[model samples]
Target: MAGPPQQAEGSGSAQASGSSTARKTFELNNDVQVADPSDSLFAYSRDEERVLEDAAPWKKDPHYFHTVKISAVALIKMVTHARSGGAYEIMGVMYGKVRDGVFWIMDAAALPVQGTETRVNAGNEAFEYMVNFQTANNEVGKDEMLRGWYHSHPGYGCWLSGIDVNTQMTNQSFNDPYLAVVIDPNRTVSAGKVEIGAFRTFPEGYEAPQTSQYQSIPMDKIEDFGVHANSYYPLKVEIYKTRLDEQLLDLLWNKYWVATLSQSLISSNRAYATSQLADLGAKLHSAPLDASAKLKKKDEGVEDDATPLNQATQDSVRINTELQNGMTAQVIKEKLFNGKLDAEGARKAVLGVL
Candidate 1:
């Protein structure tokens, strides 16, 4: 029976001098053997070692990073999921591959997790689903990897809180080159723009890099996020698009434009009221008849003396009504053009109003 395997020459010294305290303190149990001295049990030729090294290159230093690319479909899915959550926060896992030092996100899976205004928690079900998804997709040559995760902030805006930082650190420890994405659906809608961020956390005790290479996100959105911003670096995102995606975007653009062009009933009413008040003021100021004469006539029991004011008020109301009708006609035309309303439906709408 062989005793404990002997360490290679200078191997113990190298281990002692290494900067990683965890690695320096690690002890192999009785079952393991050092491969250098073994012939049949474990062996590697010099050339074979070189080939293995070439096959699996060493990972870059923890501070270094690569760009992240997301597919348009994946982004659309994330945004749709965030929007569906409404006031509550939502989270999901991202699946993709890392190639040529870039993280390319190709797909996403929504997780059925408990969420609140500030936090999200994934249970055992989420892990099971993730494993099943990875297995199923990998079998079909998808080769999907659990690259990162995304969450929504709802009304708060897109930024990582302290809890988010801790979560990201754990993920990074489990999987190097991990990413964190945050989306603010409410802020997106309110600002009429997408509020999203991609970040890579620094290794423990290392300072995060700060450079303008990343995409420009609004500072206002992240002003109050947390103090951990200095511990992570924001990454620029590129949405990959295909021909099919372009066509879909075109259709969506038309629909959105039509909806935006349609005036709301409340706004139309407000505009009409404002215009009527302005016209009434102009008429009252321009009248040449003296106020004293009108009062004297009123005292003399002239019943029809106030008829002009009433006529002016009636005219203002009629003009405002016509303006509102014209606005409605324009909206109908827009809806028909965008296919939201068919030609027959638009015609019916106009005729019914008439």
Candidate 2:
């Protein structure tokens, strides 16, 4: 996936170089296809911005990347594409220039890769697509280089998984300034903000700092979330826009507001809701509810000072509280959106003359 980083990376060049006879059948003015005959190297450029070819300051700093600035268009495209995936994961790549500690993301596009709910690894086919898409952009007069990848976590919130961290690690291990981005489409819908995170891996063997999680994650996905939480750190993300972008966003919101007001959270994420409840049931069934669930020795029991909260009890309360907040938000949305519908027959009767 594109920047902020949590998707598999692979080169598709070898697979793309097919027989000339096969290539003859598909060549067109629009250069993108199932494969590239030449298997051309991607145009990794630093053309638009001021060059720092000699200075390699980032290699020395632990927190080299302080911010990631995504174009307004890129942000919208990523969010909409992530939302379209529903429960399944989706992946894409970003085109930009990484200057100093900031990643100036000019654009983003989805890769032609099939992703399951938990995994999104770009295969050879995706590499081909990446090359073709980059080529097409150049033809159309847009020439930003591939800066990073982004993938969705669906309902699990925007944090890199173990897989994501590994993928990002492999990517950056070979290539400096590459980034990883994760998006949570379901949380975006519920929370009224694009739930996105940008990350860069530490140099190998470098220990890192870590997150007060931005949103709720499914229990099934939390372990991966926790395991790799410190392998990389997040960047401050900001969205940038020009005059045309401002107009485009205004037009989008004009059309989007209706859907925003009408959407039901539970309907949008029924699978997540069911999965959360199922996980809670399983967790409760297997884990002790409290210290009372186990027999205590007389010496252990009478430690009279109010027993400080244990880790297990604190976790259960947090999970329960977050789930309640989610459901409560859903109920509130339903009531708010159906305000007119809840009115008695007098309002309906008044309209009958039409």
Candidate 3:
């Protein structure tokens, strides 16, 4: 667990370090694994004019982020409508590529809320809600595609905050290469324009940035999301498999299902569709084209059962040598990959030495 906040501030500067300004660390739970090694950081952008058109009625604010994959969101019914601000949760998936990065996101059913305080961000629901969405992504499948997250900052320019850092670090403990996105709804100076900022932690330590660079990303370039030429706020993320290539389609499925699973697990307790996993497994097994190939790809390295762990279970594996009573990162990793140890067990074993 992380120590309590050293101090509090409306916003604090992140001391950036090697490679990037953002820094993070992830402590994986038994149900998930890092999706991409190359994606050690995150990024996002926005089309101001597009947002202006879509959020016209409510004058909505929007933000975007990157994760293990896109997600599924339930169209939240508005109990009491708010003219401006409220809160909401994002639902999405986590996916792993054969040799690349992971993607995270929310799906069609997602919606904004009117009021509520969440456990995340010191009672700030926004960031914590997103974190839960990511957790859901993991429970679904390992093949989800990352499309990034979207939400609106209260007002002013887009930037990361102290609470955002806390949330990001929480995510980092799960995996590196996650992104933080902030949307500013008060950029009235440009009316039809919106400002967005993307950030990622440095791979090593918390250092400062030399200077900031904001990159503009094409809406369509975001894997499965795109913009309508005539509109801004009401953009669309294509869900039909026929609209994408094989890799992109896989990305869509992984992103969508991960979000679905994540939300289901968190909201209900896997009671709704307990057999969803088995159904997916069956689909992979029975696909007419290359059932064997799919089965091999899907089942390879899969563990049908999980063993929970505690400190003693971890210490039990220690084989004293010239090193010590415990093991090194290498030894622990080797044991994990070789099935000699579980992820949690290995982590505890290593913590023993530290």
Top TM-score hit = 2
TM-score of each: 0.54, 0.68, 0.28
Per-residue CA lDDT of model 2 for 28-71, tens digit only, reads 54352333211221243455243542465667886878999887
- Per residue, candidate 1 scores C-alpha lDDT tens digits across 1-354 of 121223332354444433233222442332322222113212333354346334533134554445777877789899999989976899999986554445677788898886986689777998898788788887986665688999998765466777888889898877655789999875555444577888777767876554322222222333344366677777776666555665575556433443454444334344434544565566555444545566778899974433444445554565466456656756665555454447788899999999
Q: Count of backbone clashes for each model?
A: 0, 14, 52
Off by over 4 Å in 2: 1-50, 210-215, 251-256, 283-354
Candidate 3 residues 172-230, lDDT tens each? Answer: 44543344444443331122233444444432243333342222221122121111111
Query: Where does candidate 1 have its weakest 10-residue lDDT segment?
Result: 33-42
lDDT of 2: 0.70
lDDT of the structure predicted as candidate 3:
0.31
Worst 10 residues of 3 by lDDT: 74-83
- Count of backbone collisions in candidate 2: 14
lDDT of 2 at 256: 43
- Highest lDDT: which candidate? 2
For each candidate, what is the lDDT?
A: 0.63, 0.70, 0.31
